[model samples]
Target: MIVTRFAPSPTGRLHLGHAYSAILAHDFARRQGGRFLLRIEDIDGTRSRPEHVKTIIADLAWLGLSWDGDVVHQSQRLSAYAGALDRLREMGLLYRCYCTRAEIAAASLSAPHGAEPIYPGTCRVLTRQNAERPHCWRLDMARATAIAGPLTWQDHGRTIVADPLTAGDVVLARKDAPASYHLAVTVDDAWQGVTDVVRGQDLFAATHVHRLLQALLGLPTPAYHHHRLLTGPDGVRLAKRHGAPALAALREGGSNGLALATELRVGRVPIGATDT
Candidate 1:
């Protein structure tokens, strides 16, 4: 059976973009008689709040989307993340990173593919230590790619080559958080038997690293459908930082959730929505 999921981090309330993505995943699964799942990616305990998780569930339900079986929460899967990190450590593809944000910023150089600066791999050669020093875990990208050996994944019906090196050595586990999104999402997808990943194109670049992780971790690579992101009138991406209104707020303000969802399905903007 085909399985798909809408995994949302509960750092904030759900927005229009969130509603669209959830509807896309839910509709895709239900249309094909497959299973749609909901996952709460709340591993970042510092930012994740119990109330936000409740709000997310309420928002999705208000938007008329339902999932199959129990909801999966990332906080409950720390042991699995630790196990994956250990596996990477056992393969010598994991390293301790001790760089502070300022240090990494000083070394920031714009990546050719994206405006985001890639980590310069300063901590890749650092001596591994234990609890004495607080450090995050980073993937040895060069070594990891060498082991994976030319990987690729399907995206929107095309086989795209994975170039994880452009992302540099990504953090697999943080000093504060047990697992990074890249590690946790890949592990959970395989664990839940997710056959398809429907998300926004803003994450399209991240798929490169995800494919590499799937190869290294011996997990299945799910087909990806990276849809266009909902953008503001200024064309900037819709995000909480950009002051996008929450979907629940919109519904409370008298916007029709089903009408908005159908508009998104037909590649149109929601009614009274200033954002496209």
Candidate 2:
């Protein structure tokens, strides 16, 4: 049976963009007589909140989206993450990254993309036996790409070539958080036997790295369906970081979820519509 998942972090409230992503996964699964699952990506212990978790569940239910099986939380799967990390480390594809966020940004100032910078391999030369400060583990992109060999993943009925090297050496596990975002999601999707990955097109690039991880870890690759992201009046994508309001707020304010859901499904949300 086709299985898909909506994995949301409990860092903030679920907004219209989140609703669209979840609805896409749930509706697709239902249409195929398959299963739709929910996964709480709470691996970021510092930002993830229990109250946000409760609010996420309420918001999805309000939109009439029901997920199969108990909701899986990343915080509860540290051992699995550790095991994956260990496997990568054993293959010499993992390395310690000692650069702070500021340091990385400073080095990537001339990088092609502004603000969101790809990590320059600075601490990549440092070995595990090196005398240094607290560090995080990063996937050795160059070595990892070479090891994984040529790769590609199917997306929306198209064969897309994987170019994980551009993502740079991504963090696998941090000192504060046992597992990084990329590692956990890749591992969990395989663990849950997810057949399809449906989410925003914003994450289309990250699929390259995910495909590499799947190959390196000997996990099954899932077909990806990257849908259009819900945007605001300014044509900007809705983001929790940009202070997008929670769907629960709309529901509490007597907003019609069924109507909002229909609008989203038809891709015709009203201007300044707060119902969803």
What tens-digit string does per-residue lDDT give for candidate 1 at 83-145? Answer: 999999999998888888778877886655536568898877656566568889999999999
Question: Which 10-residue window in model 2 sums to the lowest lDDT?
Answer: 267-276
Runs in model 2 lying further than 4 Å from the true structure? 127-132, 271-276
Candidate 2 local lDDT, 1-276, one digit each (tens)? 999999999998898889988999999899999999999999898999999999999999888889999999999999999999999999998888888989999888656764468898888875555537788999999999998999989899999999998898998899789998889999999999999999999999889999999999999999999999887777777777766667987888888888888888876665556424
Clashing pairs in 1: none
> TM-scores of all models?
0.94, 0.95
